[model samples]
Target: MLPTLRSLMRQRELALHLLTPEDALPAGALDAAIEWVHSSDLDDPTPFLSAGQVLLSTGTQFEAAPGAESVFAYVQRLRDVGVAGLGFGTEVVRAGTPDALLDACLQIGLPLFEVPYRTPFIAVARAASDMAAEERFARRSWSLGAQRAIAIAALRPDGLSASLEELSRQLGHWVALFNANGALDRVFPAGALAASQPAGPAAAAGADGLVDTVRREATRLLRRGQRASSTITAGGETLTLQTLGRREQLRGVLALGGSSELDQAGNEVVTAVIALAGLALEQNHSLDRARGQIRAAVLRALRHGDLALATSVSDGLWGELPAEPVRCAVVETRGGQLDAVTEHLEALVVEHPGRLFFAVDDGRLVLCLGEDGLPLLTELCSAFALRAGLSEPGAYSDLDRAMAQAEQALARAGDAVGVSEFGEIARDGVLSYLTTTDAGAIGRSVLQPLSEHDAAQHSELLRTLRLWLEQNGQLDATAQLLGVHRHTVRARIAQIEKLLGRDLSGFQERAELWAALLVAAE
Candidate 1:
């Protein structure tokens, strides 16, 4: 096992004294053996530690009394400062050491290590340095062992999950595989890592998002779906991430819990791990493709004749091919910021695997099938828009639908448009009616009059006409919709027909007028 706080302490021969109110600061508190002193004075002191430097200090700079009157405030202050540990340093600060300080340290739950005045601070510092060196050596050896393990994993006849679990154990970390959408599919951790994490599929959100971001970038680097990797933070964890290739792509993110610091060496190891993941993913994809091909062939044959193969497609990397019902919802970006849109989709998928989601051709978003209700698509659109920092979600359905809706909603929502859940916009007017009609050109022509009018006055005539038309020529309904009497509806209709020089009773004529009314509303 890699060296830990317990092991390092043992090797250093540092007096093992449990911190308690009864405990006194051992004679080593002021010794130069201690490599560094931590003030725990607001913000962080990690910058001062360089690398491998042991830090010592008294807890006074961090906490105060631990009673109800001052407990939370005292602990909060110390946590905010982020001290290594408090060392009384003999006569420097507090006479010997305050019981309150030790109590506070225990209550705050920060790691507290005792220092003895007899032990020279320099010797302590040296011990820390030596321990760090030893750790580095051990890390290198483990990395080499991991390299060898990867080689062995490459040859494993087991499934991807099994091989990866062993690899994670060798690396002493938790490894997770994310899909293009950022959903957690597989997780392999060493020993207690899985138990420490919420890995049993209770809605993978935080970890899923981290893996998704990394996988997406990795995919861009190695399009083969078999070569990709990225690193990101999610759930307050430092994740050294990477991805696999396009064929058998694995959007995997690896995280080791001991240290938050990331070095060039760690990055190299992460890169190598990613390279190995790429190989595995490529192999997985090829195997999947072969399996998919055979299944598809049989399904197609069955479809033509009789056997019933499930209509739904697997969430495989082959684009929900030949089976699943995939719809392309185009999300428009500013100039060329498609990657942001992809990120939004990824954020959504970790919670709801509603669809096989992907960004297509940069300007558009595509979704596979939804596991929940059809309305989830609407909610998802709302969420994606909101996360993208948009305010009100507009009619974001397909590329044509969402783009058009977003364009219109964006005007009012401004940046808030995408942020709002557009599916709940209460769209029950001309806009809603127009959604069903592909009446693109004629509708615009009908609304041109209103555009000409908006340039002049914000008149009620056009508005009344739009309301009446949306009510489907029903005088009573139009009256209700427009908050006017039934007679007002008839009168407005007469004026509108006379103004346009056409009777609006026939279906064709009604369609044209309705289109025009919609144009004006927009």
Candidate 2:
């Protein structure tokens, strides 16, 4: 800190005397910061000085302007220019300090001190300059020390968390870290206002409001899908938010909050932390990708009937494969929503490590979760508006067959936004096996003649055939459902049989056509 007016007067070597009475002192008058000291004899010296400076001058200016009003105007000009105080050199061009100057300063509330003959103006300026220089040195040293501590913190086992805590301690403020999903990953200084209740009622309310605002802002930044920083003021504190990772793929957000603004050194420390945190996130991202690749490899092995190999590879990392009689779920979402869904599932994998194991195959999210986790999978599919298929419980050795069942169910799921369980459709026995075969494609080829005839003649033969098959060849039921007469349904059915060259009298042909429609709906 720089020397104040009160401190200058306390220096014995300077021997400065306060001309203004203590009772007449203005607010913050005694502790006025003195950045520099200047001596000028001109009547107007305001142009040469800056704010937070002390002016030193002989009584020559007072000699020119001898009246009390003139002296008052001079003090007003110095005050207007934010001069910390005025120092009048006595015993030079005058016997003592002028009465008009003393009265003007006392009335205007501008601090005035008498400089004794023994103390040179140079000494006062040098003293203030030295104090300023020492402050700069102290701040720079602190910055270097803080940077060193942060760097050391970054080498710890939990480097990211440790470094953030160190940064918060050094800054004497709260720091929060969020993951790519905008979920709060960590917060420094445990039991902070953001993490725990405050002591006072007013503070408690303020803390709650601040936490909500911070979360909303963090989410908004990630949703913007850009690399940026924001400064916000809430609950009487300033908060700084910065996005980590690249603009194209944001990893997370880092937030720092405090009651005061950061100085130059504090800003430098923050910059260092951001760089370190960004590098850490990038490293973690690479590790996550490697783990995903390993998971995919394991899933491939399981599908290839290499359960032992899969178990050996994934046992330590992700816990045992969801045990025998595991159910497989295949989930898929819109193209733009893949990242959001992936982040949610990744978080779940971390939370429920042993109970669930999932891997992305092609564009779909495939999972081999325990029977107990089926309900959670169903909820996830509904929550994310994802199209999913669940296979019947099967042994780990039969994972290949189970995956085929899930794909067949998924294909039959069509464009609907929900889960399709293979068990629901598998009760038809032979139909289940037939649905998975290329028979659906062959049936579609067989029905092409009917589709073209209907499109050309704008007839209802295909619709009549589907309804007839659905109603089990009940003429009255199909006709009533179609809002047509039984005779018209009979005529359309006859035309359908002739066009497709398939005898609808048999259940095999009708089931094949129905299966074809189901597969093609996807």
Candidate 3:
């Protein structure tokens, strides 16, 4: 401990005289502080003394600026410059401490000591200087000891947690280590205010917002080899957050979690923790990837089939199967190439955070979306389209369909337009014939009579009848889709029925004609 002004004066039996009581001096109030500076400048004590050093001044500096600031202001200026305490001379300055200065010192938490006329300024300076030298030696010794402990922790096979715990205990803080995936792998409860499972995916607010801020900043630093510190809120309490990354191939994170900023020892522990965790994550990428893939596969299997099957494939595989009925989406890029599609897919996931099943095939992204996945997928498709022209959405499906049906629909949509045919093509071969068959042949076969009639009359009777059938005979909806009034739509349907010599209202007739419409659309 550095020698305080009151403590030193007592060693010389001077605390009794200097701290005489009527306005009794508190314990250790009269001793000369070891870390103090001589400051005669009343204008700005900052120019004279560095931060954290006590200031000693005479009344002459304040006399020059008496026109403006009071002695209170003068004391405040010195304190603002990191002055620990200030001493005033009784001989050259006011006979007694000024009430204004006294109030300022007490209010601002700055310590003030009296310099009696009989006391020599040189003696006080000499006393403080000697104590400072001794204090410096102790500080170096403590720092060296801490550094050695950290070095030893670095060499341990499993010493990261131990080193951090010890460091936090020494420095008075909390410590947590996070893996690359943002999970807390270790936590030592040195200063944590709440009891939470820190290793879980969810973390609560900590001291100075340390919990949330540390986890977030730690993950970021570990990933990019960057460092950050901030104040955060956790459990309705404020806390300090400090994050550091290791210098290794797979850098990890060390988090100093507490209500106060970490001291030097705490920082070193943070560094050591980062080194161990980062190295572990970096070295275990292959294993991590494999485990992640397995988990994903299990989740994937759960999507279309039984959970048991997904669970049986591999541990952690298929862990994230999307909830059903999964929505399918197609993405088309500029060049018709599948390359770089995965990157865009990943980016899409990041931009729209939710459950999504995205896979790249050829030049497209086939995503089996989670809840609201279709709309998100649409937005993603639009973004990809804006970036480059290779992305597009083709064939689609019903709001509900079997997994097999949805998959087929996705396939057909990838190959053609309308987005609903992957299943239709497989079910009845209609989508395939309509999309892949020679359009002229199919059109001639289905719309030949219409061509002949239109050749004679000039009307879209075939198309009109097809629209009529699609509306399920609902005059209103079909009209809306066709952008015509109900009367116009009915008339078109009537005209189409008459031209084809069939009652379009009949279910069979409607079905067969709908089939032919697909063919004609080819």
Ranking by TM-score: 2, 3, 1
lDDT order of candidates, top first: 2, 3, 1
Worst 10 residues of 1 by lDDT: 387-396
How badly does each model clash, as a count of residue pairs?
Answer: 58, 0, 49
For each candidate in turn, the TM-score is 0.39, 0.67, 0.45
The lDDT of each candidate is: 0.49, 0.83, 0.56
Candidate 1 global CA lDDT score: 0.49
Best candidate, lDDT: 2
Residue lDDT tens for model 1, 385-481: 4322121322222324444443344333444423332443445554554544455566667656555655577656666766666776788987787
Q: Which pairs of residues collide in model 2?
A: none
The reply for model 2, stretches above 4 Å from the true place, is 1-34, 57-59, 65-120, 178-185, 190-235, 241-253, 333-351, 371-391, 401-522
Question: Counting only residues 3 or more apart in sequence or on different chains, how many pairs clash (N, Cα, C under 3 Å) in candidate 2?
Answer: 0
Shift of residue 405 alpha carbon in model 3, Å:
11
* Predicted structure 3: clash tally: 49
Report the Cα lDDT for residue 486, model 2: 95
